[model samples]
Structures are given as structure tokens and as C-alpha cells.
Target chain A: MIIGEQKPFEEIWEMVKGHKQLTVFGCNTCVAVCHQGGNKEAEIMASLLRMRATQEGLEIDIKNGGIERQCEHPFFESAKALLDQSEAVLSLACGIGVQFVAEKYMNTPVYPALNTTFLGDVKQDGFFTEKCQACGDCVLGVTGGVCPVSRCCKRLFNGPCGGSSNGKCEISKDIDCAWQLVVDRLQALGKMDDYEKLVPIKDWSKDRAGGPRSFKLEDF
Target chain B: MAIDAEKIEQPKSPEKVRDVPADWKANIIAFACHYCAFAAADLAGVMRLSYPSNVKVVRLPCTGKLDQIYLLRAFERGVDGVFAAG
Candidate 1:
């Protein structure tokens, strides 16, 4: 999932300040799973903004609404009335959603309420850890389902670097050495031979370094 | 007269207890790491040490795992204060 964290309320408040009509727009997909930019969050943000505006005696028309997904145009169609009425939109979706809304509604100013963090999985409730970097290359087949490109601090492909000590990275005691984990998994799977095999230097063009990446289907 | 007698004989349900009091002294949410803060809380219990009862602890693997949403949600739900203990 694409994990994100909401920007501080004060920072968000500053963005929409002085706007006569504002909508707290939320996305119910990726950001919602992280508990950051869902319908519930939109309601909370609306309440907070309303309470603050009342205390400061600010005259603002604030509305709260959410869509199934914000990156697609069809999902946004449902919110056309609210968007038309809004002078500005404070988007609680990820960076892409905010940009999509901004592009779709060129006249209205759109502001991001979340700092897009990382591609990660929910370890448990309220806990998420980054697991992928979308490097456009798959290496998990030989690495025993762990991507060294994302987990390793140095992105080592061959083996553990000199910085690994006692299954932990030298950089911090809290971080387990990614190479150590790879080796351990390989050993458990009786695939230590895979560790001995040398992996060639990765092609940089296959990664984000190449440019903006996309996949198009000719069948479509 | 019959309705009044029936009402008097009917069993009454117990009043529900509020998790948060209307006149609350404090409403605190404490995010405690299982390794340290949770252990400390356990020790306090074993020693019978007294502390504010209003502080509710939520356990996590590490304090680094704490998310800003959890803190915000606490305040949104009427919590007065929040503390993170590693």
C-alpha cells in the first residue's frame, strides 16, 4: 500500500486560511488503509477546522466529502457539485490524488494535507514498514522474497557488506542488516548456492533513474 | 392505577458507566513500547505503585512505530493529552 502521514493541522490550516469556501476532500483507497486520508479523517479535519474558525471568528464555508478514489476522473465526477461550490480544495489524498484534482479543476486551488511517505505494508494496526521502492526490476526471486534494493541501506546485491555485524547494521542497533536476513532465509531454504552466485551490476535504465515510468497495454 | 403498579414492579436496567467522565480530571492516551514502557507499567503494577488512572496505555513493538494519526484520533475522540513512552 502507499502509506502516508497527515501534515500537521496548523500547516494545513495555513494553506486554506482566508478562503471563503473550502472542501476537505478525502480518498478512500490507499491512504485510507494507513488511517491518514479517509472519510473519517476528513470528518475530523472538518470538525477541527470548524472549531478553530469559530474560536477565531473567521467566516469560512467548510464542507467535508470523500470519493472512492481520487486519481481517476470517474470517481471525481461524483463530487462535481461540491467541487464547483468550493473556492479551494484541501486534499487529504496522496500527492497523486492532489495533483489529479488540481489538474481536473484548473480554476480552483488544490492543497495537499498529507506528506506522501513510502510504499509499505501494514505490520499491524497503526504500524507500517516500507517494503518496496518500485525500482521496475524484480530481484525477489533469487533473494528469497526480500528486495535488497529497498531494504538494504547500501542496496547491496552480492552479499553482506563490512558494515554488517552480528546480524545488525553498523549504522544502528535498531536496524537488522538486510543482507543478514537474505542469507539467513537462503540458508533455511537450502539455497545457500544462490548466495555464492554472483549478481551482475543492475541496469540503471530500468529504474526511476531512467525517467517517469509507465506500462501501456497494446491489447487495450 | 394498574399501569402505575406495573411500572413500579418492572425491573430497571443499570446505568451505563462512561469511559470518559463529563467532569473529567484528565483524558490521556499513552503509546508505550512493549520492550520498555510496557515493562515499566508492568513493574509498577507488580510493586503496587500508584499513578493517575486516567492514563490509558496502547502497546507497540517500538516507539518508532508510532503514527501521527493515532495521536490525532485520540484528540478527536476527546482525549485531553497524549504521551509516547519508549
Candidate 2:
């Protein structure tokens, strides 16, 4: 998912300090999954802003709204009424969503309420596990489900590094050796013999060396 | 009137329960995380802690699980606020 986190309140306040009217917009897609910005989250943030403004004796108008997907123009347009009333917008979406809002609402200054994090998946409950580094390589098939690109603190491509102690990575005891898990899984599946097949050096040229990558496919 | 009714004494007057009328009812909808926040609420209940009874809780696995459509949809249905306790 598009992993992200809420920006500190102090920073957000600084952005909208001079604005009399504000719109707090949340995203429903990636940011919502991680609980940074959703409808309820937006409301909580709005209430906090309300309380803070009240305490500060600041007459700031706060209107809360969120869209289905902030990256898409259609979803953000749904919040037009609330957005139109605001002098500035505080977006709780991912960087993409925030940018989209800024681009669409040219008149209103858009500020971000969350820091954009990389692609990640939920670990258990509160912990989010970072998976892909977005290195533009698809190597999970050869790694036995363990992603060395992300799981390895050092991002090792080959076998276990010298820093591996017991079954854990030396960088952090909480992190298990990704390669060890990969080897174990492969061994159990009688594919350990494939380890001898070394992979060729990755060509970064195809990755993002040309800047942002885009792909298009004609409709079937 | 019967003779038994004459023996009854007058009751004392009742006192007012409020100096000011109770405030308007607060409609609270909280989307709580199943991990920490939900456990905390359960603990509060078990400890007999008192809180405003106006809260309506909707438990979710994580704050991450919430979707934008769901949040907006609730307000479209007239929910006053959405809270993330976790």
C-alpha cells in the first residue's frame, strides 16, 4: 500500500497559521488503510484543531472533508463545497493525493498533514512491515517469499551476511535474518539446490535511471 | 375523606437536580483500533471506569484498515464526528 504517516500538529499549524478558514481533507485509499487520514481520522484532527484554536483564542474556521481517493480528480472534486469555503487546505492523503489537491484547487493553498512513507504492509496490529524498496526489480519469485530488498537491513542480494548472528540480523535483534528464512523455506520445499544458481547483477538502467517510469497497455 | 387519610403527613418538597439544564446530547462515533485502543477500552470497562455514555464504538482491526469512502459515508449518514482512539 502507499504507506504514510500523519505530520506533526505543530508543523501543520505553522502552515495554516495566517489562514482564517481551513479545510481538513483526508484520503480514503492508501492513507486510510494506515489510519493517517480517513473520514473519522479527519474529524478527530478537526476536533483537535478546534480545541487548539479555541484555547489560543484564534477564530479559525475548520471544515472537515475527505474523498474516496485523493489521487483521482473526481474524488477530490466531491469535496468542492467544503474546499471552496476554505482559505487553505490541509491534506491528510499521501504525497500524491496532497499534490493532486494542490493542483486542482489552485486558488486555495494546500498544506500536507502527513509525512509520506514508502510502500509497506501491516505487520500485526500497529506495526507496519516495509516490504518492497520499489527498486523496480521483481525478484520475490527467486527469494522464496522473503524480500531481501526490504527485510534485510543491509539489503543483501546474495546469501547470509557475516553480521547475521543466531537467526537474527545484527542490525536489530527483533529482525530475523531474511536470508535464513528464505533458505529454510527453500530447503523445506527441496529447492535448496537452486541456491547454487547465482543471479546476475541487476541492471539499474531499466529501473528508474531515466526518472519516473510509466507503462501503458491497450485495452483488450 | 376517610378517617385514615387525615392521619397522613405531607411529604417534603423535591430539590432540583440541576443548576443548569443538561447540555445537548452528544453523538459520538469512535473508530477504535482492535489492538491497543480496543484493549484499553475493555480494560477501562473492567476497572469500572466511568466515561460519557454518548460514544458509539465501531471496532476495526487497525487505524490502517479505515477507508476514505467509509469515513465520508458515515458523515453522509449524519454522524457528527469520527474519532480514532488508538
Query: In the order shown, what is each candidate's alpha-carbon RMSD?
Result: 16.9, 17.0
Find the 10 residues in a row with the least total lDDT in model 2 chain A.
A47-56
**Model 1 spans > 4 angstroms off:** B1-86
Best by TM-score: 1
Give me the TM-scores for chain A across all models, comma-separated.
0.96, 0.92
The digit string of per-residue lDDT tens for model 1 on A1-220 reads 8898988777787888889889999999999999889977887788778656765678888889999899998997889999988899999999999999999999999999999989999999999988999988889999988889888899999998999999998988878889999999999999999999898989878898999888899999
> Model 1, residue A214: displacement in angstroms?
1.7
For all candidates, the clash counts are 0, 4
- Candidate 2 versus the native: TM-score? 0.70
Angstrom error at residue A93, model 1: 0.8
DockQ of 2: 0.02
Error of model 2, residue B1, in angstroms: 86
